[model samples]
Target: MRHATYNVNGIRARLPRLLEWLEREKPDIVCLQELKCADESLPIADIEAAGYGAVWHGQKGFNGVAILARGDAPKLRRVGLPGDPDDSHSRYIEAEVGDYVVASLYLPNGNPVGTEKFDYKLKWMERLGSHARVLLAEERPTVLAGDWNVVPEDRDVFSAKATRHDALLQPETRAAYRTIVHQGWTDALRALHPGEDKLYTFWDYTAGCWQRDAGFRIDHLLCSPEAADRLRGAGVDKWARDQEKASDHAPAWVELV
Candidate 1:
């Protein structure tokens, strides 16, 4: 089945593009990030009208995640990471679609590095790692997809040395991402396209980032070992980044048998 992940940026703002994408791509399942809307504000009817069943979690102005399925909607398995009950970032939501377990995540954007926010980002990564372990233990077809807000390697971004001190490219963030991969998960894009570089999925809207192709490969699809074995192909929908009123990010996906 074909499954896709996209950080729509803001669902309300990108409704038109999203609708067009749904009609064109027709993926079996879609994981969305950064809804930037409250739960009540979610455009539920409009999404349903677009011909897909969806389940979502949202907060006031930042951080939201959702899952959409073309068939009968999947079972809601979990919402938010388990480590801290007080953490309410609306960054995680998981579901079962067909035989695969899916998770949509929006890991924190740790801006100013030496602050509480960065620390929280690391803690959140730990929680994700723990949750992933549990899912791996289940031995089911598991696909974790989302805007991880992490640069897996220097090659994943446009420049390695240039972004060394940046929040998303910091060593801690990369290490955390590496830790997750070490737990028997395959980084689908890299595993499938071993020597390829500059296959970025996100570009900044400020300062003509897209025009210059200045981008970062923050969004990802990490599959459990078993799921990786079924990998068919992976790609970035770069055209989405060029649409009028487009989001800074584009859709990325992997097809599996």
Candidate 2:
């Protein structure tokens, strides 16, 4: 089966593009982030018509997430991430699809270095790490896929020097990401293309980032040991980013045996 993750930026505005991609790629399951629509406002009918059942946690005009499964609705598991009762962002959603426990997350974009947003970013990651540990304990096939918002390494970005002050490239952010992966999850893309130095999943709409191929590998699919053993292939759908009125993020995907 094939599983994919995409940060659509705004589901309302990007539904056509999204549907087009779905028809073309035909992944068995898909995790979506940045719906930017309220729960009631989601285009559920259209999605269902496309032959995918979905469970979504949407927030008005901002963060949101959803999981889509081909031919059936995923069994809902959780709406929000654990460890923060008061946190209201619709950034995480988990569900059971077939034998896999899948999570779609939109980690905070802590821009501008010294700000509350940056602090929240780190704290959120800490919470994610703690929760990931619990998931690891289950020993089930699990896939945590989404726009992680962290560049992860110098090689993951087009220009490390240009992104030094960005939250996504911050040392603490990368460290937190590493801490989670250290709990025995495989970074799918890297596992398949370890030596490819310039693989990327996101490109900014400004500064001709896409045109210049100035992109970053922010979206990721981290699979637990059980799922890792089935890892067959992985890649970024770069052509999707080149489409007209495209989202800044392209689809990142993995195939399993």
Candidate 3:
């Protein structure tokens, strides 16, 4: 089975590109982030027409997430992280698909070093870590895929110096993400292509980042041991990112036997 994660940026605006990718790649399941649409506004009909059934957690003009299964709708598992009741952003959602449990998440981009947003980003990561432990304990085939918003190491980015002040490369952010992977979840792409630098899943629209290949690896598919044992391949769908008016992110995927 093939599982993919993409941060579409905005679902309504990217619908055409999305359908085009669906037809081309035909991933068995896909986790989408940054939908930036209201619940009632989800283009359910259009997605269904493209042969995918989806379960989404949407926020009007900001964060949102969803899981799409090739045929039937994925069985809803949960929405939002469990630890914070006041955290109302629609940034996390999970579902049961086939024999595996999958989750789609959009981690907070806590920009500017000393601010509440950065604090919130740290706290939210802590919550994610706690829940990840529970999922790991379940001992089932599972995949936690999303735009993690963390640059794991200097090698993962084009130039760490360029993004030195960015929150994604911050020590706290990297540590939080590291804490999760240490719990036995495999970082799919890295595992498959070790030592390959400049492997990226996203690029900024400004500064000709895409043209210059100044990008980083943020979107990831962390697999549990059961799933990792069957890993066949993994890569970024760069073709999707080259389209006209493409999203800043490209789909990153994993294939399991």
lDDT by residue (200-237, candidate 2, tens digit) is 99999999899999999999999999999999999999
For candidate 1, give the lDDT of residue 29: 88
lDDT of each: 0.92, 0.96, 0.95
- Model 1 Cα lDDT, one tens digit per residue, 77-137: 9999999999979999999988899999999988779999999999999999999999999
* CA shift of 45, model 1, Å: 1.4
Models, CA RMSD each:
0.9, 0.6, 0.6
TM-score of each: 0.98, 0.99, 0.99
**Which regions of candidate 3 deviate over 4 angstroms?**
none
TM-score of 2: 0.99
> Could you tell me the TM-score of candidate 3?
0.99
**Cα lDDT, model 1, residue 47:** 85
Between prediction 2 and prediction 3, the one with superior lDDT is 2
